[model samples]
Target: MAHFDSNFIMSRILLTDEPTQIGCVYLEAGGIIGFHQALSAQLLLVVHGPASVRCDSESEVCVSVGDAVFWEKGEWHETKTETGLMAIVIESEALNPTKYMPVKLIKD
Candidate 1:
């Protein structure tokens, strides 16, 4: 068995604009976010420590506190941690949520 700190919790709140959702996340050393897609153009800023980010067709880059990065809609990317990382992120609900429809799942 393996013990993982699993720093995956994120705090998100809809902005006054209502169409924008802002959030923050903290990742301890060794944390990783596997490849994923962004439904809306997303912006992220490193609040503290260092963050490693890689976008589709691009080499990974290390961004320090105060650095900002953007990913276009539908872009594939991934983030990993070499050290602790803290970041703020924003995504537009108008673009992503408007098309979201939950599918029903039958379970026992």
Candidate 2:
């Protein structure tokens, strides 16, 4: 078992490669994380701030602090930031979440 910390701020905690092949996310603040189609189901634990997730033609949902959201795989979604957003993403086949919790998730 390994512990990974956020390089950006000290508000986030992470657990990698537990249930699935990937890790789970715990956000401490709010920020913008790009958009893309997921290959796994993302378990979003919003400890603070509000997050807006939009995929395809689906309406955006405002997730506040203490809210837990699950984003399935193969859906195009983008993180909307107004006042910084903190949310975790679950990698489907990811054996570790901490190792994948970076800007690398957002493909360019």
Give the Å shift of residue 72 in candidate 1: 0.8
TM-score of each: 0.67, 0.54
Question: Candidate 2 on 1-108: residue-level lDDT in tens?
Answer: 134743553433345445554344443345555678776766666755777766666777776786655556787777665766555554554433345344223221
Q: Cα lDDT for residue 63, model 1?
A: 77
**RMSD of candidates 1 onward, in order:** 15.5, 10.9
After superposing candidate 2, which stretches have Cα over 4 Å from the reference? 1-30, 93-108
Per TM-score, the best of the predicted structures is: 1
Error of 1 at 28 (Å): 1.0
